[model samples]
Target: MTTERREPDRNADERTMLEGWLDYHRCTLARKCEGLTDEQVRTASVEPSVLSLMGLVRHMAEVERAWFRRVLVDDDAGWIYCSEADPDGEFRLTDADTWQEAQATWQAEIDIARRNAAGFALGDLSRGRSGSGGEPFSLRWIYTHMIEEYARHNGHADLIRERLDGATGD
Candidate 1:
């Protein structure tokens, strides 16, 4: 499946530019996983590294939930595929985990994230703290952080995809 990733408007406002770049990175990730089998997506990047395409998707879902629902919206909604007992659980695939399910969950989180972000201005501070006992973060900070997070992970996705099938490029 081809992902319709658009370039950020060069002349757009800060908010629009940020949102566009974030969405572009998001689609880049999805495009990286296109045409892969479930088994392929589940395949680890390399020895001693548990990272996989599907794992990235799952991890991003948790990130979206944490920043948007838990932080921005200040909702009590918790991690979708992780827990305090297994903080990195999303990166560890189970036999039952499928790409379809992971993609659906990730898309759902993205939807919630968009809605939550829309309610706040870029300069608005979050109701929730940054981390355990940390200070509250502004929407602007969250946006910048999220874009950076996705950009870094998308780099990993590129390598994972190329390793899996010689496919490359955003």
Candidate 2:
């Protein structure tokens, strides 16, 4: 079980502060799934929704790969989990999907993302394509979007955990 040890500085520069807070949220998400069984991680929040700890982890891996490898690094390996054939595959957890593998994959993506974004400044533009042919973005935007993505999913994790075993936290 992973424990929470993320502590962000109250004061820092833009990059430092954003990275600290983003790491805090990342650790927070990992903490939300601590000590859970494979089946437990796959348990959906409600009957109608596809929300689960495993699904969230998988989705984050997809996000990390897309933003870092495809968008940031200009690679073509897009959508790690979902696809046009199975767009919701990340949330489609089965007994074959182990938590150990999920954690490792997510961690690997996180590492790649960190490395890919390391060379760029906050104001650097993205080289990825867009609807209008191509539109650039700041590294700051990527960092902030990552924070928001984790924050949203972490909230879902909180609800799912609470529903699973009455566990709760900030």
Candidate 3:
């Protein structure tokens, strides 16, 4: 499916603006993966680098679950594709990994993130601490961090897509 990404409103309130940009970046990632074969989606940007469109989807899914469910709602949402033993498991795809599965999982996590964030104000503090020992994160902080995370990864995605098929966009 084609991703429909909208520009974040310039005059929106703080929360609205943050959510807008986050959704934009989310759709940007999805757009990057569109029209590619499963193998193409799983292809790494470079040798020895596990980063791929599929891997980014999986990694973002993990990030969404971590920041929204585990930290925000204290839901004990364990990693879906990663673990304590292999923190980067999402990027290390196996033969079983597929674009459809990774996309669905990432979208599911995004849905959960929206629901969890809806119950709290932007200033609300997380129920859990960051990285097992860091300070509690405010919803504001999480939103900001998520945007930055996506922005950086989306840059990687842009280059990957260009390398794979000469596709490029905002």
Candidate 1: tens digits of C-alpha lDDT, residues 90-166: 99999988899999999999998999999999999898646666878888889999999999999999999999999
TM-score to native of every candidate shown: 0.96, 0.93, 0.96
Better of 2 and 3 by TM-score: 3
Which 10-residue window of candidate 1 scores lowest in summed lDDT? 128-137
**Please, what are the lDDT tens digits per residue for candidate 3 over residues 109-141?**
999999999999998889864655677889999
| TM-score of model number 3 | 0.96
What candidate 3 gets wrong by more than 4 Å, as runs, is: 131-134
Q: Which number leads on TM-score?
A: 1
Per-residue lDDT of candidate 2, residues 1-170 (tens digit) = 56655667767888888888888888888998898888889898898988899999999999888877777767787676788999989998876888899999999998988888888888887766432556766788889999999899899999999998899887
Error of 2 at 123 (Å): 0.6
